[model samples]
Target chain A: MTAVSKLLRRSETAVLAILIVVMLVIGVINPAFWQADNLFNLLRANVVIGIMALSVLTVMISGGIDVSFPAFAVAAMYLTVIAMNAAGYQGVVLPFIGATLIGLLCGLANAFFIHTFRMIPLIVTLGSASVVRGLLLGLVGTSIINIDRMPPSLIAFGSSTVDIGGSKLSLMIFIYLGIAVLMWLFLTRTMAGRAVFAYGDDAESAKRVGFNTRRTVYLVYGLAGALAGFAGLLHSSMIWLANPRDFVGYELDVIAAVVLGGASIFGGRGSVFGTILGVFMLTLIKNSLIIMRIDNTWQGVVVGCVIVIATALTAWRDRKALV
Target chain B: MNKLTDFRRFVNRDNNIVQLLVITAIIFLLMSALEPHKFLRYYNFESISFIFPELGIVAIAMMLAMLTGGIDLSVIGIANLAGILAGVFFTRLYPAGPDAGAAAELMRVAAGVVLALGVGLLAGTLNGLLIAKVKITPILATLGTGQIFTGFCMVLTGGPAIVGFPAWWGFIGNGKILGVAVPLILFLVVAVLIAVMLTKTPFGLNLFLIGTNPRAAVFAGLRTERMVLYSYMLSGTLAALAGIVLSGRTNAAKSDYGTSYLLQAVLISVLGGTNPAGGKGTVLGVSIAVIALMLLASGFQMMRFSNHLIDFIWGGFLLLVMVINVLRNRGR
Candidate 1:
């Protein structure tokens, strides 16, 4: 690292370091924390959040907060499962595919508003988020859908684990890491991808420079919605049940992850590396808390504190950057 | 083509009104077509007018704060806290015969009003202090306070609702005065008082000017801070009063009583043509919009749809109205 970079360690680096230290402390206090089964379960638990955080990072970087992503995911998941079940197609792939496309469709609608209406992203997504969540609740009508038929492929997709030297690794971890790499490549290696970064930096300046900043904004939000959908698919497959109330506060966690990763909510500037580190940082804190056998209720308090501290620091940095 | 262009501008100029009318029409048609007898009743229409006043009062409070280029998310929380205080005192103030007939019960209600208003004013002043002195962004700072204050309410009530408030206080909520609910009449009085302050007084003028551009207002020698501070304090007091009304209407206090009002009140203000970025909008417009929303919702419920359906439609309608507004605004 450069000398200057050393003094001001990037948020991702700081987050990851904290995660590792916390992990080590947990392992020391309770060996069960580092145990193969428990760690795998923990990773499994964060799969949806980790994937959704990637989506949030994209939208936030593009100067919009797509709060509807989670609700859209719920819509996708419910519609897919209910439709396929009614069709007597007991296969999970059909539902997964259905949900993903529906997510993209919702994203497209969001994009249209962002580009056409110029409605503030927060307002648009939040409004639609409620609508979508409402529809999801309407569809299920207080009933849980249990997927027990012909879904070996889907279950295997989420259930598969790699045994690495007596330590088990979840398919979720691989899925999360895979998306991180794809995001990294898309962000760093492609023209449209880099344009996403530019638009996020400043829409006014970016528009002046002849970038189709408006269109790019739509695509970024669309992609975020799609990712949230994909994550929802993974969520349902792993749980083997579709409940409307599942992931009620999913958007909050995703935003928290992105902010903790050092992304600005006012838009422009984020790193895939930072987000990945954020995912692990929260995962670590949660897993460690469990390992310590502390009251689960304290989890909210701890997470809340970390989130405030992280966002405050990021905002402080943004203010400093302006200077 | 000429007709089409005119139609678009009409929709654009009065987007919120158009949305409200459209929603009302939809509900009317649905009721007539799907559930006629219940929907066409005049009682339901009257109910909408009555229920609307409480929301109207809150909207006025929200508009005053928004007019000063800030927000008061804590108002709903303050309302909830006030409601709980009212509930606690009602239960404890009288072990009377068949009602809270204890003269002490009246004192308790009075005490509840004052305490609630004090709590709300303190919260709003704290918000103003942070915004004026610490220079925190209004959105973020209010969001944080919203959480802290709401969290405190949840803690105070242990996340459950309070019920069994005094009967006399409940009567204040349910009683009619001169052919209108007493609370509704009270709301009208509050609205008129505020309308006078917002349009006729220096405080109101300063508020509008400050919202348009605080720096310019400051340069122009207005005490921008005082205007903002006063606006928030007024917002808090009004919200607290509304809380008392809401509790009396419901005959109980719940932690979640005003939780949903946060979004709904803001939506009404914005829908009433109040700019979120502030400077433009009137109490008259907002009051009308609030009445329209209540009518629309009650009209639908009267037509036999569930509350969930209304909520779904409400969220969608708000989105549609807000999007149209944004499309019209030439953002700088």
Candidate 2:
């Protein structure tokens, strides 16, 4: 293929170009938007979304959509916090393990249902989303979790950061970046990662090629659940309180970002880089809307329009490629 | 041998109808047993019947879209928007006056219904165009348009409900006609219309063919795109009708009203035996499913069950039904 065609084909390139254009427009509209402090704040605010976007990207690339991530994250985070408060556990590893385990179970349930029934992943995840959210509310009610009494290690993780040119950066940024980098390696360089793409591309063919599609499906969903769990822990730490309503409707945001990042909802097409850009693009749109003094009610309008347009553009591009 | 063969045919015909009937029986018996004092009362039944149609109409609308292997998540959005539009037109065109005559009131009601239905048709047509013409996936397209519609409604009302309807406006929602609730009658009319459309018409036959195999349908000279568009339009209009019932009953028009109904609509449609994958469902199946769910929901509410638990049950019930359907299909 020609270099121009190859470059145009890469989702990351297209996303990066769009990101630049958006940034340029926003910066032109309000130079204050380009301020380092504001930029850092935006990244800090979107750390959870950024992290969750990667998990979604991976799952989507593996040929499934998990709308239950928010539910998994909230449930895991709540369980961890409740456990720590009740048992007085100090170390972070215990809580992380606890959260990840819950995520694993939720993911397993998702995979089990999808595989056994041969049902659409979207429908299965949709049902599971409610079940988990309902369980959260039914079992825990509307209680708010306060982390004021948590161990110092937990506090440090949420609050501590290195001085980067006299700017306050939360430790969560590094965690987010670290996970993205690792995910990049896993998706691009590992056999399992290749298998994920293969399975997503065509499950029947992947099975014929000796790839264990079902196991891959389980692992992908389980890993997504685990990452969501970790992200939830970080989220609760950053916010210092876990309300039951927290993260309830944020799955749509995550899905939108991932889709914007150039991941086809049809699966077998997405990247970690694209997801990061997608998250950044969405976060930037949100921040820009605030900067431009747009009413909060219009935020949905802007985001929804962007999602639809982005998907439409992607669909058009796919059709063109086929032609 | 003839009697045994006849019994086998009865058992084997339409598993879903049988399953729905058996489920209805079980829930009825259970509710009767548990709430022996209240369940069988005419008042309780009336209350259940009163609240049934707003959701039932929307579910039937969703069933049409599902029959074409697509879903209309925009139902709630369109419903709310339609109500809001009707509200806007009604209040603006015929402001409430102290000495307004019956003629003015009749005009206001007629205007509201026409405006609401027109808005529903327009919104649904947009959805159909986007999905069929633009080739966007139903989930994302509806998701986006749902936002847009809701956003427009928000801009119209500025986040609060629009109130102040004529005194007679609530008749359709709360009044009874010949010993039957007006909304129930409306629901029945809608259900019958959809039933006839799906089973007794060539359009419905082609819809099933298109859903089952798009390429085959295309080869057979069916206008698949138009079929999908019409299906969505029909779904949208029905949802809007539901919105009218909702607004009338509550005496307000709000963008966020019945947010829960989005999922409940999908649940009801699925429970009614509408296939999510398309090409297989019936209006009768959906109506029966809605009744079953409403019964369960009311029973649970009467027992003072938490709303969260009810949500849990709804979600779990959806999953359970799908699983059973899978097993039954496999057995066949």
Candidate 3:
């Protein structure tokens, strides 16, 4: 492959490097870190965050950051759970659909302020983020409303695992893999995918070349919103409860993984595979801390260091790109 | 009506300061209406003025960084970290201390402040190196660093609050110079110094230029990296100062200490009309915004409002200002 093409592929390489290092380090520190049970648990716990990170990657690549992501997701989770409980609905699919729609609505609101009003994307999203979170808190009365009537199948959404020769993978892994493949196709194969990249790379230039800049920005944000919503549904289904407070705080971690995965905040770059690798690296590191019994306080320190180093490396790549 | 229109125009251009005064006046009026006996107490006014100085100090430092075309999301993090470190060093959290003798205590405080400033410098330099040298986007880099610093603080404290500072430094927090609180006086000195820096120093000039036009700043042969680095360092150090005061007042520090301040700082910064996308804003404007926010909080308290509701009100105001800015910019 040409050198230019090779440079374009480095995002995935960096994520892979991070994944390998942490995996080996964890394995060395505690042999059980690589054990099947623990790895599957790690995968299960990170399902919601990992999915959100993938969504953030899309918008960041398309030239905008979705600060409203966590808010949207949490809001969706809150609404779905509350609506289902209030309605006494029994169907799993209907509740999940309701959640997805809530997320989409939040995303569309962000896009409206961003595009139609010509507001700065960051400012608008930041505002909407707070508003959405407040709305959720107001709606949920700032309490954890547990879903006691959760069906057996619903409970299994987060718990069910398939055992393959005593080495099992959690259902979360499949969900992540499925979503990653779909996003990969969406970003690489279609006119919309090209638009996401072009808008992020240079929106004005994209507009000059006759691309629909406004629509592209809106769609990217909308897609980001929908995915965040979907993640909320998965989270509630997995955990058998919808929560708001913890999820918004987790957005920082998701953004960190995306950036560490080699997505440029400047937009027009990054991919799903890199992000998946980043999620795996973070999840492994966190779970390994639990296994090593090293106070788990060091989890933040380790993750922080990894982010700094990875970003530094990516910065190095960016310099080379500019040159 | 013509005169009023001109006056309104002036207020619009300088609305943050105007907004603060108007809100404070409105609050006092409301307080009197609710219960003239308690709300108009001299002590309450003293307390409000007393708390605002440190906030104003941090605001100026933050404004400097923002003026230089970057946001210092790490400010609150640094402040919380420094406060905890200061508390630990002062009270001897570990090593159980020689009880940190007065001289040692003083030394630790200074060192704590310096390290906080040093951390700021290092972070700012890293930010500069990336934006100037590595070509990473400032927003994402700062955002990452903000969390990392916050995570470091959380890790150090095990996600808990660290306590045990001598009440003596409450003197620092509650101290007054000729009837004005020490913090307020310090704030004034800081404000004047910042005003001079922005207008008098080449570094300041570089900041203004960079914010307005990076290409032009580069063309002017200004060391843009140095200017940006200096801005970040100042922001970090100022945030650390705020942390010190917070620790002094509360006699404790925690990991989650300044998470709330993240919104507070940004709210004031944005409310003061400092363009979030970069290049435009003033220290006076941010200071006014801080005062406005403080007043709003006090008003909420007077009205028997919960902290959560206060936050809701603050968020609502932020949204309103953003919408207005969008509409005005759209017209342009």
Candidate 4:
């Protein structure tokens, strides 16, 4: 009984409850929402954003925020595609690896400036976001790569699916689940992961306790960048087009997801489970609006209201606890 | 000898203003040297005068928010919403065929301006309440509100530009007063007023104190929450003023117009030496930085550089300024 009550007290449980409630409400509004194909489509649509949210969760856990990952993601995706087309490379693994590496480099640039100058993470990432995006659009090419120009292997990979009870499921969902599980393990059962929590909770104390704060910072941002990069490529593949200007205003959405998942913007709190739930909640609300027959114009207002109300509630709860 | 020393001390007191002046001078000289025929033309400078004020005002608004250890990402959204609403008002009550007397037209435009500013005031109040009373982090609160504002704009206009503003409205953006661009004059007046407010007002001093140390300010018996709320309100009004100028200049208002200005505003604020971490900035410094960037942008355009490259340079400039500030602090 105690264990069950404790579970209910956890923030993840609240997020889960909310998610279920929203799903049920939407399902009732539009019976088509409960269809297996629609469900699978929703899950598939969440793959890229889910992966990026996990990255954001990591950074927030380390007491920092990154608005540059979307820029990094698009840069990696566009540059990787451009490079592959130029070199006549046709494989998927090499492009993914190259994109991830590029993302890691951008992340490190952020980590370097932040660590060396002791600058605020927000400002550093903001600057880097601008630089990466400007370079991608300016130095490289600004045109979108259509299906004819996109590598065949990537499109094939994107289109590949598994039949589950006569329903087609994109193979990308499994990768997202795999990454989420790995992240959960890394954040829960590892010494390095604990170090991240400690640093976020109290940086000065963590340093005094001989934790390698520098390594923690790098690990957090580097992993975020790499995931963002991988997600970017995956997004292009799934969509079957590579647009340089993709993900222009996606940072807020991803950040909103993570925060809604019960992550503290002030740091030292968050979970992979809660974050995934948050992503689903957001994705469902966004995708189901059309099914529910709501005017598409009201989408932004609805999402914005949800974000503000949810964050305000969480903040209020935290304040009450302090008092 | 005494007056000279006093002047030196004044200059040395805030090195950022002097540094901004020097940078502006260098940019001006370099642009002139590179493209004398194009850059030094009368029309080029005139166009810049008309263009920089909207961005300049928004940057100042950003600086005000930063002063209180917060940021108002909703500035651009507020600008657009204000402009769009004003456009809606004008379209609804526009005198057909100039049948109405000139007095009525003037009244309509004046009412439109008030309505636009009122929208800003209300939006800012919401932002302030969210940040102050609700205790949500400033960034997240503003981000959500920005979306709401933009979404409201879309619902109002149904995803198209609202055009057909009054002819007199254009004068605010494009007219000249005593050989000075109207927008330029407005920007200068706003800058001077803000400089005085920051330096002379009790509210301004309280903002710096609160940003520098919230706990201390609270203990010192300051109404930190109210001060923050007021600052955001002022920021919103300034943004609305920018929006008015923007709509007047373009003779239209759209949901996505000046989307890029958000980035430019942040860049200009930081370039002006406003510490993002809060408690430090100067109106004079920000004004000079905006002009310097305007000059650089114009020069780049003259040289046929893509707008993207200019954006890239602005980002690089932000990072470079960060490094310089750090090194200088270390030396001190």
* Per-residue accuracy of model 1 over B1-332 as CA lDDT, tens digit each: 99999999987766656655665566567656765676567777666655777788788888887886676666776777778776665566533356544686677666767776787788777667655544544554455555556555655566678888766678667878777788878888998898898889988888889889877898999987777777877887788788888888888777667655766787788778787777977776787678667767766666566665666777787788886666556552
lDDT of 4 by residue, B1-332 (tens): 99999989988887888888888999999999999999999999999999999999999999999998899899999999999999988887554355877888788889889999999999999999998888888899999999899989988998999998998788888889999999999999999999899889999899899888887898999998999999999999999999999999999999988988987888889889888778998898899899999999999999999998888888888888888889989998
Worst 10 residues of 2 chain B by lDDT: B89-98
Clashes of each: 1, 1, 0, 0
lDDT of 2 by residue, A211-323 (tens): 98888888898888888988888888887787677896677789889989888877789988889999999998977887887877787778878888987887786664321
Fnat scores for every prediction: 0.22, 0.50, 0.35, 0.63
Residues A1-323, candidate 4: write the lDDT tens digits. Answer: 69999999888899898888888898889899988999999999899999999999999999999999999999999999999899999999989999999999999888888888888888788889988998899999899999999999999998889999999999999999999999999999999999889888889999999999999999899999999999999999999999999998899889989989999887889999999988988898889899999988888788888889878977986785321
**Residue B188 local lDDT, model 2:** 93
| TM-score per model over all chains | 0.83, 0.95, 0.90, 0.98
Each candidate: what lDDT?
0.74, 0.85, 0.74, 0.91
Best by TM-score: 4
Please list the residue runs of candidate 3 whose C-alpha ends up more than 4 Å from where it truly belongs after superposition: A1-9, A147-153, A320-323, B1-40, B93-133, B329-332
- Candidate 2, residue B270: the lDDT equals 83
Which pairs clash in the backbone of model 1?
A: A200-A268
| Candidate 2: tens digits of C-alpha lDDT, residues B1-332 | 99998877976766678899899889999999999788888998898788989999999988888887888888999999988887887677668677878998888788888888889999899999988888887877888888788878887888999887666778878889999999999999998988898889989998899778877888899998999999999988998999999898888989989987877888888877788888888888888998999889888888988888888888899899889889988987
Off by over 4 Å in 4: A320-323, B93-98
- Looking at candidate 2, what is the lDDT of residue A292? 80
Rank list by TM-score: 4, 2, 3, 1
lDDT of 3 by residue, B48-104 (tens): 777887677666666776786666666776777777776666656333255568776
